[model samples]
Target: MSNDSPKLTPRQQEIFELIQQAIATTGAPPTRAEIANQLGFRSANAAEEHLQALARKGVIELVGGTSRGIRLKAGTLRGLHETRRAPASAGKSRLGSLSGLTAGNLPLPGLEQLVLPLVGRVAAGHPILAQEHIEQSYAVEPSLFTRTPDYLLRVKGMSMRDAGILDGDLLAVARTREARNGQIVVARLGDEVTVKRFQRNAQGVTLLPENPDFEPILVGPDTPDFELEGLAVGLIRKDF
Candidate 1:
C-alpha cells in the first residue's frame, strides 16, 4: 500500500471488496439497496453512511447526484489489485481492464447523456411522476431512441410480448398527451400503469395488448382516471 493510503476499518474493507466485486460483475457499483441486502444492513441509509466514510477516507470517490457514482481512486485501485491473493487466472476479471468505462471520475459515461428518472411503482392517488415512485435515474444517449425520453418505466408483465416487449425491460417514454392511433404508449388507468398500443375513436379509447392471453382495456372519454402518460420510444433489455 502507498504511504498516503488512508487506514480503513475491517467493515469498510469488506464494503470496498463488495463494491469491486459488483463492478467486476455488472460493470457498475451496487446500489445502496443492493449493498444493504448483501451486507444484511437494516436499511440503505446504513450502507450510505459507510460509503460516506469510505469517501472521506480517500479510498473511493463519489460523484454527486449519481446513484452508481462510486469509483476506486487510482492509488487505492492499484493497491487493492496488488494486495489480491487470488490466482493469475482471476486477474482475467473484467475489472482488470475498465478503461473507457468512465468519464472523468464517474464510473459511467458522463457525456452525450440524458439523465431521466426510472419509475418503479405508481401508488394509488399519487401522480405518475411523483418522487416516491422514482427508483433511480439512468443516463442514456438521446440518440439511442427515435425520440428523446422523459423517463424510463420498468415493464411489469409480458402483455406486450408479441410486440417484442418482455417483462423486466425498460420502456423509454416520451412525455406527450397526444399519441398516434397505432403508437405504443404508457397509459394510466386509475392507479394502474400499462404499456399498450393506443387506439382512439369517437366511441372511446382502447389499450390493446399484443399478447393473446391478455384482454384490451377500454376507457371512455369521460373516465376521470384515464390519462395518457407518454409514448413508448425505446426499450432497454439487460442480459443476466
Candidate 2:
C-alpha cells in the first residue's frame, strides 16, 4: 500500500466500518438515521457530518436525493481490509492486473477484477446463461459488490430509476434462487426478465418498481414460467 491511502480519524473509521457492515449485511447502505441509531449518536446530523467528511476524503461518495445513496468509491473499497492484515500483505497492489476467472483473477493479490459475462436478453424456455444469451463480458471489481457477481445484466428500462438504477446501467448479479424482502433481484416472469425489489406475503411475490409510474408485477408461487434468477449485487453506470 502506498502512503497515498486516505487516512481516517478513529471516529471516521468507526462510521465508515458501519457503512460497510450495513452493505454486507443488508445489500444496502444504512440511512443516516440508521447510522445514528446504530452508533448511539444523538441525531442523524452527526452521522451526516461524518459521512460528509468521508466523502471529502474520497473514501465514499454521497449521492443526493436518495436515502440510501451512499456509495463506496471503487478503488478504496478494499483499502479498509488492507489495514487489518499483517504488514507483509501491504506489498499487494489493489490496482493489480485485470484478471479474475474469465478476466483471470490474475495471480496478483488485493482487490482484483472478475471478468463477468454480460448477459443480454432471455429467450423463453432457455437457460438465462445459455451461451447465446451473453452479449459480451465486463471486468468488474469484486470489491464494488457485497458479493461476487456471476454475471452483468444490462438494464434496459427506467422502472428502477427512482432507486438510482437508470436505463443502460450494468447491474452486477450474483446467481440466486431466493431473496429477502426489499432486496433487489432479477426475476423472470413468463418470457420477460425484470429487476425489482423482492416482496412476499399472502398475495405471493410482488416485483415492486422503484418508480410509481410503473406497476408492480405479481408472481404466484406456482406461477408457471416464473423463476428467481439472481440478486442485484452492485451497479455500474456507463460514462456516455
Candidate 3:
C-alpha cells in the first residue's frame, strides 16, 4: 500500500489477487501450482517465478519448505476484525489494563516452535530413515499437529490409500524407539522400511495396508528383527 513498494506487472497483480482471496477465505494461501491452474498458466514454474517476484517487491512473505506459508503485506480480515473489537466506547475498558491479574501476568506466546526435517523419497526396500538423508528442516508451530513430530518424511507410495495418505504427502513422524499395538508407524522390517498401521496378535505382528489393492505383510514372532522407527503424528498436503 506504500508508493515505495515495487509495482507488480498486470499478470503478477492478477496472481496476487488470487492468493489474497484464497487466504481471506481459507486462512491459508494457495500453492504455486494452484496459482498456475487458476490463471491458465501451462507451467507451475511460471507461478513460482511470479511469487518470487512478489516476495522481492515486498508484496508478500514466503516461508520456505512448508505449505500455506505465504502472508500478504496488506492486512488480513482477521487483523481488521481484531481492530474493530478494540475499546471504542468510553465505558468499555480494555483487557490490557487487567493483564497483571493473570497467572503469568504476560501475554500468551504465539505458538510452539519445532524444527522438522524433510526426508525425501523413502525407499521401501532400504533403510531410508537414516539421519544423513534429510534434505532440509522446516520450523513449524507444534499446534499444527495432534502430536509434535520428530521429523517429516515425504511419502512415496500409495500403499496407505485407505488411510488417506497419498503419494507426495508430507508425513509428520514422531520418533519412538518402541511402539504399542495398533498404531500407524514408520517401521523397518529387516532391510525394508514402510509406513503402515500395525497390528499384533499371539501369532505375530502384521503390517496392515490401508489400501485394499495392497496386501498386508505378516512378520512372525520368530523373526523379531523389525524395528519400530516412529509413530505418525499428522500429515500435510499442498493444494495445487
Candidate 4:
C-alpha cells in the first residue's frame, strides 16, 4: 500500500490479514460470521462494522447480497498469489522482465500456469477424476481460479443460472469433503452428480439450486447415499 493510503487500526489490520489467509487457503473470502468467530467477536455485526472500516481504507471491496463477496484489492491480491518457494538465481528470477506484461500478471508459462483436467460425465460408483471421466486437459492461468482447482466440470443444465453458472460453462472444482452454508458445491447422490448450493440444517442437508423451478435435494437420515465430491471454487464461461 502507498504511504498516502489511509492507515488502519490494529484490529483492522488483523481482519485484513485474516481475509488474505482465507482466500489463499480456501479460494474464497470468509463470511462475516466466520470473521467474527475467528476473531472472538460477539456477533457478525462487529465484523461487518470492521469490514466497513476496511473498505473506507481502500484495502477491500465488498459486494452486497452475497455472504462471501468480499474482494481483495489488486495490490493485496498479488501477495496472496506469491509462490512460497525461495527465489531463483540472478539470471532466472521468477518475476521476470515485464516489458510486454502488465503488473500483477502471473501467466508465466512454466511457473504460473495450472494444467487442470477437464472431467466429463462420471459413471456410477467410480471416482469423479477417473481416467475415463477426463475428457481433456487445459492449461489455465492460476489466477483465473480463486483457489487452485483439481479439475473443470462442464455444467449440464440451467439449475444454477441465477448464479451466472450456465450450461456448458466450466466449473472449477477444488476437491473437498466439507462445505459451509451457502457455498456452491458439486455433490454426488447415488449414481448422479450435480452442482448446487450446499446447506446444512438440524433437519438434514439441502442441496439448493439457483433456479426457482428446480427443487432442493433433501438428504435425511435414511437417505440411500450422499457424498460431497468437491467445492465450487471458480467458473470459466465458454459461451461468454
Residue ranges of candidate 4 with Cα displaced over 4 Å: 1-111
Q: TM-score: which is higher, 2 or 3?
A: 2
Candidate 3 residue lDDT tens string, 71-127: 553222223224335556322211110000111211125644577788875544455
Instruction: Quote the lDDT for 180 in model 4.
Output: 87
Q: lDDT per model, in order?
A: 0.70, 0.73, 0.60, 0.70
**TM-score: model 4 vs. ground truth:** 0.58
Which run of 10 residues does model 4 get worst, by summed lDDT? 92-101
Candidate 4 residue 223 Cα shift, in angstroms, is: 1.7
Clashing pairs in 3: none
Give per-residue CA lDDT, model 4, range 1-240, as digits (tens).
333446789899788778765654544567899999999999999999999999887767776655765766544433334432224322111111001112134334555678789999888889999999999876666653455689989889988765556678777788999998877889988878899888899999999987787999999988876889998766554422
Candidate closer to the true structure by TM-score (higher is better), 1 or 3: 1
Question: What are the runs in model 3 whose C-alpha is more than 4 Å off?
Answer: 1-112, 121-130
Per-residue lDDT for 1-240 in model 1, tens only?
434678889888788878766654433467788899999999999999999999999877765544555656545654544444356535432231111112133223544677878898898788788999999887765533435678889989988765556688777788899887867789888788999888889988999987788999988867877889988765555444
The per-candidate count of clashes, in order, stands at: 0, 8, 0, 0
Q: How many Å off is the CA of 151 in candidate 4?
A: 0.8
